[model samples]
Target: MQKVIIFTDGACKGNPGRGGIGYYLISDAGKTLKGSKSYLRTTSSRMELMAAIEALRLLKFPCKVELYTDSRYLADSVNKGWLNTWLASPFFLNRKNEDLWRRLANEMQKHQVSIHWVKGHSEQAQHRLVDRLASRACNSPKPLIDPGYFFKI
Candidate 1:
């Protein structure tokens, strides 16, 4: 499978407020691709998960993905095996951001994915770039509404 390296970040004005997600992807062939989106109402975790989901969705074929994120929630869920447990447990249905988790779970089935955690606001240029992208996206004049977030309650 083709290997890809992806760096993602999410930012929110408040715990549950205007938010944005960004991802930077580099293919084995050295091609680069990036994406960012702003949400009118959302949480940081949701955007973080969305960043990975959106990046995975962009892949036209199955691949080996090394995904990096600043959110330990996103990384640990997969890296520490919470995701597998959640998928097998009915109790996960009541968890916050279950919708996005399920979407991310489905996306994972399409690729060989490994999630890594990185320190936020660090000196890493990739993290800094995606961080800036997400932060800037939050200021989009006409941000899109996060439907799942609205229905979260």
Candidate 2:
């Protein structure tokens, strides 16, 4: 199976405001893929989850994956099995970003994935790259609103 290293990041102007998601994927062969998306009404956690969701979605087939992210909410949710608990919950009520979480769960089932946490605003090049990608999305002239998500506040 192919191996991939993925780094994800998200940014938001306000807790419930303009947001963006970014991801950087590196294949075992050294190919690098990067992308970003912006949303007019979203939260940073949503963007972060979206980045991870998109990263896994890009995989053509199941493979070994090492995912890195700065968002503890995302990293911990998966790594600590909180997401599974939520999935096992009755109706998943009161869970934030349930839609994105469902998408993430679907994408994850397609591959072998592991989540890692990193410190944001660090000097790491890949980290900074994703950070820049997400930041740029927030600065786009006309970022489209994400139909998959909305801000509650």
Candidate 3:
């Protein structure tokens, strides 16, 4: 079975404020697959989910994927099945990051994926790289699009 590894991180200048996501993918033989950073004028949760969704969508082949993210919200929601219930009735009260979550759920169905939560800013090399990328994306002067869903809130 082909195997891939992904590391993802999200950063917010302020809660519900400017944010970004960063991710890097590696093949089973330790070859780099892809690395990306995205800016968002929104919350960290959305960035977190976007990171995962974008990483999954970047895959060119169907393979067993092991994804790592620092966000418990993203990791637990998927691994523990909470995301499925939310997708079933997405309009429930207190729902947030709906668009990103929906995108994540859809991308998730395309591959055999497993999520692992890692401590942010820890000793993990990939996590550290993701953090650096996310910080750069958040601090970069480039104009960012307001992820659209914020106006619906």
- The C-alpha RMSD of each candidate to the native structure, in angstroms, is 1.0, 1.5, 2.0
CA error at residue 17 for candidate 1, angstroms: 1.1
For residue 106, what is the lDDT in candidate 2?
93
How do all models score by TM-score? 0.97, 0.94, 0.89
Maximum-lDDT candidate: 1
**Candidate 3: residue 85 lDDT (0-100):** 87
Question: lDDT tens string, model 1, 7-59?
Answer: 99998898788899899999999999988999987888888998999989999
Ordered list by lDDT, greatest first: 1, 2, 3
Error (Å) of candidate 3 at residue 28 is 1.4
- At residue 71, give the lDDT of candidate 2: 95
Stretches of model 2 off by over 4 angstroms after superposition: 148-153
Compose the digit string of candidate 3's lDDT tens values, residues 41-145.
Answer: 677777788778888998877889999998999889988989888877736435776767778878878889999999878899889998888777887677376
Model 1 alpha-carbon drift over 4 Å, by segment: none
Number of backbone clashes in candidate 1:
0
Model 3 lowest lDDT segment of ten: 144-153
Q: List model 2 lDDT by residue over 1-153, tens digit each.
A: 999999999998887778888899999999999999888877788889988998889999898999999999999999999999999999786677888888999999999999999999889999999999998898777877866554442
